[model samples]
Target: MSKKFFEERGDQSAVKAEIIQKYFATWANIILPTAQRYGGGKIAYIDLYAGPGRYKDGAASTPLLVLQKAIENPSLSGALVALFNDMDVNNTQTLQSEIDALLGIEKLKYKPEVNCNAVDHDAEEYFATTKLIPSFTFLDPFGYKGLSLRLVNGVIKDWGCDCVFFFNYNRISLGISNPMVQSHMAALFGDDRAAELRKNVEGVKPALREQMILEELTQALTEMGGKFVLPFRFRNDKGRLTHHLVFVSKSFKGYATMKGIMASASSKADQGVASFAYSPADSSMPLLFELTRPLDDLEGLLKKEYAGRTVSMLDIYESHSVGRPYLSKNYKDVLKKLEDAGDVSVVDPDGKPRRSNSFADRLMVSFPKVKK
Candidate 1:
C-alpha cells in the first residue's frame, strides 16, 4: 500500500476535517437553493479520488458526509447525483460496498452510483453524459497527478459546475524541485506546459514553488474563461501546508458568499471553537485570514455592480438567484443611495412604486413585504 494512502485513511487531523466540512457546507448553502428551485434539475456531487466511507479513526469520510448532507438537506431537493472514483480496485470496491450498505439503510428519493476507475479519465466522460447541468465536484486527490487542468476545465464548461479541489502542493513542489523527478511534472500539468514551467523556475524555494504552481493553476482557470476566488492553504498537524483550495464561479456574488463563509470559518477557528483556519501563513498567527483584503475588494465589487445596475438590490439578488448572509447593511445603503439618486427605483410597502430624485447611495433596497 502507498504511504500517502495510509496517511489519508488514518485520522486526518482536526484542521483537515474541519476544512473539508466547511467546503461541503459552503457549497450546500450556495448551490442547493438553485437546485431546489429549478424544479428538479440534476445536481451532481462527485468524489474524484474517493476513499472508504470511514476513516481509520472512525470519522465519516468526506464523500459519505456529502452524500448524507445532500440526502438530508431540504435544499438538495433536486436530483442528488453522485460519482465516486478511486484508482485502486480494492479501495473502490470497499467504497462501493460502503455506499451500497448505507443506501440500504433507508429508501432514498435519489440514488447515487459509485465507480472504481481513474478519476481524471472518468470525470470527463461522466460530465459529458450525465444529466446534471449545474454540478458540484470534489477533486480531493492525494496528489496533483489525479486530474489535469484540461480535464477539469472541460468538465466545468460541459457541466457548468462548481468544484472544491484539494491540490497537493507539497507533493507537487517536491516532485518538481528535484531535477531527478522533474519529468513527472510533465505528466501532471502536460508536456508542453511542463516545459514552460521548468523554464520559469530558476531559484524558487519548495514552498514558494508550490505557491507559483497555484498561481499558474489560477491563471489557467482564468484563461479557460472562468474567474476564481484566490486559493487558500491549510496546514496539517506537523505544520506542513496542504493546498486545499476552493474555487467558485466568476460571479461577484459567488465570491462574496465564499468570502463570508471563509471568514466565518476562520473566526470559528480563532475562538478555538472550530477546526478550519484561514491559512498556514504563520503558526503564531495561523488563525488569521490571509484573504481578508480580497474579500473586502469583493465587497467593493458588489458596490460597483450595484452602482452601475439600474435594478433595485432585491431585484439584483433575484437576477443572481441567491440570498446568502453576506449581503450586508452597507450594501443596502448602496442601493438606497442609488434609489435616492434617481439611478434605481423601488416598490414601497403599499404597492406604490417610488422613484427618488436624490442620487445618494444610502437607501436600503428590498422587495416589498408580501401581502398576507
Candidate 2:
C-alpha cells in the first residue's frame, strides 16, 4: 500500500546508497576514461523526479550522491546541472532546506539548480538549456506513466544524453490491469500498443506482469537506438522481489560498471547461488533476469566461449557478452561437468594446468551424463 525505504534511518541506506553511489561512480569511471581516450567534455546528472534532498531514513539521497561524486572526481572537471522536479510544494520546501544545510556545511564546487515543477511539464526545457551533451540522467519517477517513450527519445536523440530509468514494474503491472489506467497506458504505449499489451497481459498476475514490463521496456529502449542490459532483480528481507530495474545502454560505459556492481550486490546476498523451482508462470514469459555470470562458472563459459583459440578470461567474458557472476554460477559447473567427461582441460590465466582435465575421451562419457 505504501512505498518503503530499503534501509532504516541513520543506516547507510544500503539499497539507496548502493544504487545511487554505483550509478554515479560508474558514470564517472566511464566518462573520465572516455575523456582521456577521445577528448575532454561536460557531463551532468539529471534527476527527473527528484525528491526531497534527504530522505526521512537519513540516506544520502540521489541528489547528494551525485553531488558527492562530482566533488570527488576533479579529473572529470564537469558542471553538475542537477534538474530536480517535484510537484509537491512541501517536498520542494524540504528539499531546499536540505540543500541549504548541505551548502552551509560544505561548499560544492559545481553549482546544482533545483526546480519545483512536475517532470512531464519541465523536463524538455530544463534539459534544453543545460549543455549536457555527454550527460547521464536518472529518471527515478514514482510512476511509469510519468515518463513517456517519446520523452525518452527526446532525451537521448535531441539532448544527446543517456539514462538509467528506474522502471516501477509493479506499479505498471497494477496500473494496466485496472481499466481506469487505459489513458495513462496510452500515454506511454500508444492506443494500439496499449491494447495489444493489455490483450496479451490480462491473465498475468502482479509478479509476471512486472517481468513483462521489463521485457517491453528493454525492447522499447532498443527501438529507440539504445542497447540495454537485462533487468537486475533485488530481493527484500522476505526474499520477495522488489519492483525496480536499472537499465543501461551501449553508448554509456556506465552500464558495464553498473553491471559489475549489480553482480557484486547479488553475490554478497548469496554468494552467486540462485536456485529456483520452475513455476507455471515461467511459461512463455519475457522477463529479463541476471546480467552477469560469476567467476567459477566463467571458467567453463570461457572454454565454450573460445573452443577454437587460446583466450583470456576477460576475453571470454567479452566474446559471449556475459558478466562475472554468470561465470561463477553456471559456467563453473559447466567446467566441472566437462572435466569429468574427459573432453576439456581447465587451465589458469597463465595457461598452466589447474587440474587433470578429461572429457568423454573414450566414448564412454556422454554429454549429459546421468549422476549416480
Candidate 3:
C-alpha cells in the first residue's frame, strides 16, 4: 500500500496505463469464461492495487475492465465474486462509486451476479487472512515491498488460484545491491537467493543484469510451486525498462492459456518485446502478432528431447508445449518437417505409416537408425 507517485500526481494519460489495461482485458476475456466453465463453484477476481475505476479522460481502469469482462461473458453472468483492495481509502471509495454506477445501468447487456466489495486495506494483509477460493488474483503494487513469495505460495497451496503480478524491475535493479534493501528483496524472493544473485551480477551491464534478475525471479517462482511462470517486460516511452508482468499458475493448461494471451498482445514495433498500446481515438491497421519458435530450433529441441527414443505425439505435447514458449501447433509442424526430411518416422501404434492430417495423441515417432 505504499503511495504510488503517479496516484498522487493525478496524471491520467499515462502510456503505461494503456499497456496494463490491454493486457488485463485480454487476460480477463480468456480467464473469466475458462474459469466459469471449469471452476465448479463461484470464482473470485481480486485486484490488490485497485485504483479509481476511471482516468480523468474516461479511460476505463483495471477494476472496471475486469467487471465489464465478467458482465460481457454470459457464461460467467452470476458466478463472479470480485474483491477490490486499495490502501488508499479515497481510491477505494472512487472505485466503489464507479462499480455502483455500472451496476445501476438498467439497460446493461447482462446483469452480473457479482458480489463486489471494495476494501481499504494492505494487499499483503488481506491476502494472508482471506479464505482460499478459486480465484485470479492481480497484485499490481506500485513498488516491490508488498508482495512476498511466501504469501503467493500459500495462496496457490491453499486454493485453486492463478496470479498475475507486476514485478518492479526498475526499483529492484536500483536497490538490489543496497544492504538496506537486502531483507526486503530476500522476503520478496522467499530466500537469500536474491542476495546471491546480486553479488553474481554486481558488475554486469544494466540491461543484462535486469535480464539475469528476471530469470532468477522466474526460477524462484517455479521453485515455489508455480507450474509455469511467464514474464513479459514493459518499457517506458524513453524505451527504458519499466516493469515486468509475471503470470504464475499451478496448471499447465492455465500456463498455456496465459502464454497465448500474452503472445497475442505483443507489440509489432519490436517483435521481441511483449509491450503494446491501444488508443480508442486512432483509426489505423490493428497491430497483430504471434509467438513463434523457429522451426530449426524446434527441430533441434525435439531431437534432443526424443532423439533415439520412440515417443507418442501426446507425450511430446504434454512434455514440451505446456510450460514452454512453443505451442502445440509448433510441435506438430516441427514433427511433420522432421518426418518429411526422413529424420524421423511417424507411425500408428500398430507400426503402420500414419496418414492423418492431424497427428493423433497415440501416434508414435521414431528417429532414423544411426548406421555405424
Task: Tell me the whole-model lDDT of each prediction, alpha carbons only.
Answer: 0.56, 0.55, 0.65
lDDT of 1 at 307: 53
lDDT for model 3, please.
0.65
User: What's the TM for model 2?
Assistant: 0.70
Steric overlap count per candidate: 8, 25, 0
lDDT of 2: 0.55
Ranking by TM-score: 3, 2, 1
In model 1, pairs of residues that clash are: 336-363, 337-360, 337-361, 337-362, 337-363, 340-358, 341-358, 341-359
Clashing pairs in 3: none
Q: Which ranges of candidate 3 are over 4 A from the true structure?
A: 1-40, 103-131, 237-239, 268-293, 349-357, 360-362, 369-372
Regions more than 4 Å wrong, model 2: 1-13, 33-40, 76-79, 103-107, 121-131, 157-161, 189-192, 205-207, 267-315, 322-372
Per-residue error (Å), model 3, residue 140: 0.5
**Which candidate ranks first by TM-score, i.e. highest?**
3
- In the range 114-135, model 2's lDDT, one tens digit per residue, is 7777666356554544444556
The better-scoring model by TM-score among 2 and 3 is: 3
Output the worst ten-in-a-row residue range by lDDT, candidate 2.
358-367
Residue 238 alpha-carbon offset, candidate 3, angstroms: 5.3
RMSD of 2: 7.8
